[model samples]
Target chain A: MSTDIAGQAKKMGYKNIKVYLEGEPAWSKAGYPLYASNDFISKGNIVLIDLRSVEKSEAGRIARSVTIPSATLKDKADSIPKKAPVVIYSDSEDEAVSAMKVLKEKGLKKVALVPGNIAGWVKSGGETTSGPVVTTIVWKRQMEKGEVSITDFLKVAEGSATDTVILDVRNQDETTAGMFKNAISIPLDQVGNRKGELPKDKKIYVHCTTGARAGMAAKDLINAGYNAFFLNEDISCKDNTCSVTE
Target chain B: MQKTLIKFIPFLIMASFLTTGCAQTGTTVPQLIPQHGTSGGSRIQDRPYPIFVGNVSNVSNKAKVIAIDVGKGADAKTHLVKFDDKTKGIEYAVVGHASIINYEMRGGEPWATVIKAKLAQLPSGVTEIKTTELKSLLDQGTKFTLVDARPAKRSIEGSLPGAVNIPSDDFKAQANKLPESKDELVVAFCGGPT
Candidate 1:
């Protein structure tokens, strides 16, 4: 896509075409700073960390950012969820960069630096909160709309629940190798015509090998007034046993 | 006859699903048919040279090989290309990050000549920007258009503060978003090196 854009720019007679090939991932990995849009900084599901001293943070800091001073970052790293993107800001660029390295070394891949640190955030019309600083990092993986939790899906798969039915939306050839013992086979393309075969009272859980087709099937079932949810995970089954991975 | 028909119904359903399912999903069923073709011939000599672009799935520095995952889902395939001192930007081929590799067939395997996080070959007259230069430009509030060529979803995650999104997928349609002057300095970036 970047190549395509570069070609399009060249065709338009743009003389000075420059491509930042290493782009965002490289930039962030190097501890170079990034600017999260105000909306995302305020509302996005990210672990915003203020790396300023407790005194400075208590005076004023970006709203929703947990105060984790640069000095104590190494000790507090374990509390930070590796999956949630960590956005940090500090009094100085060096401090923030060091903190980023600390998190990265601790195996957090999604660490990012807020440009200009907290001062920049305040300068850019971002909201702030004063008073005591929040030190604890609290986060949970939020499910997308119409998605089922792995726990719930496993319960149904394990036959602990009888109120829900598992719908296998993979192709017939895929299931010929193996399939869930109680699952009803309905390829995604045939779901519309075969909707009447499923009971409306029972909750329908749609699943595919990689969840793409299952999501589509879930949407169709949802529109058809069936209580449907899709399992958004990689699932493989063989000999009546299934393994699921996120 | 009734019992036989009942037993064969599953096969009939399977046949119908294979035909209709593959058609609708645009995914081919993997076939295990034996091949009956001449061996020891130039497989790609007549075909246009292929360049594989994808995220690096694995990098075996010890083995001097990089495995790239191309395509997605059912059509996905991995290409293991051998690299050496001649391979450019080998350091940037980090795992799970984008890389572009153009290779030559060596002993029936692809041997990478160039491995880059960006285009394996840059268009003539175009220049590449180092990360530091971009950072300095943004810091100085340079009067140039910083374009985020990545998709909208990625840009939303985070980008340069003043960068405008002109996703490469919608470049032509969104040309108006670029500066009006053709001579204006424009820098475009995407998810590192793709």
Candidate 2:
């Protein structure tokens, strides 16, 4: 947590700051119970993937963590959600960073690395569950079912002017270049929390710079009871005029 | 029958980015997507501008933008917010990060209704003092607590001449270390509500 942590407490009506020099290590040594960060596991919404081998995960792992391993991430690219904040951990810091790139490439929105990994978790007194190692890797079967084609999308967006809404699921920095003619910009990271803003009166069409994030958002919106579909193709825009392909 | 549908790639990846454009006659203005940073951030504005920082109320589970006070205690006025990415980086959460939304004072539409409406207040036993007042107090040698609510990583960069370092996170846990005097004028502060 950055000063933003303190900023939040103050915002919530707090008034002081103290220092713990030993940090998590000393607290762990003292047998203090270390808990997962709020952002990672709060509300059972965050998805944690263990990048280490199956043997390592089975030995002892953080509760509710999934397994995708760094190398095989490409194979399961569509499994992760674009808006949900995801935590990727492994045996070492290097492995975690390597695995993070996989998600970043897919534009999985906000991703973070757990510094301590299994060792750090142990040092911090986090409970270690050793068993058959139930995994959280629930592969999303065939997302192309809800796929929207470029021609079909252009038709809805520009065609008969039906009740079709274009949802853009990219970040603030990326949109400075420009956007689709009439799509709404609700960043992929905040889509889940901002679902209320989405209009249910129209047929929703979600898209991103690449189709990676759009696919994730499509799945999410559909599950949430919205008439939504993802434009699973590459698209670009400048000065409000966008060009779509595939 | 199994069929493979291959979609071409690398045609400008852009959507929902049009800030200044006219939607066709059939379409409406950009409604749902709040182009937050694109607006007031790039516009010429004075420092210490009005910025609302809180969960977007009314519409539950979403973060909205209504920067600045509007007579009502709903949103807060801007204070010295230390939004340094190095020492004080932003953190993301389910609700979203500390959204430092900047907006040019529009025609009193945003502040009238919606979003956070609670007046931010200082915690009990805490009183806010201005930098000038603090300096005066230091010059007059008024004995008081000048606690920097920042973490150790930030304090190492150097704090006030005599301000005690106490990261706000551990402040509650280390309450015993604070002055035992119940009457001591305790002043607490940190990167004000971002």
Candidate number with greatest TM-score: 1
TM-score of chain A of 2: 0.43
What TM-score does each of the candidates earn?
A: 0.58, 0.34
Clashing pairs in 1: B117-B193
TM-score, candidate number 1: 0.58
Model 2 DockQ, alpha carbons vs. true complex: 0.04
lDDT per residue (tens digit) for residues B43-82 in model 2:
3232323443332211111122111211113222211112
Residue lDDT tens for model 2, A1-246: 213223334444444532221123232233222223423342245677778878888888877778776777888767676655576678876667666666767887556555466777677666667667655554222335788778778886565556888888777766778887677899765675678998888889988877766766666677667899888777887887778854
Show where candidate 2 strays beyond 4 Å. Answer: A1-44, A133-246, B1-194
Grade the docking of candidate 1. Answer: acceptable
The fnat score for candidate 2 comes to 0.01
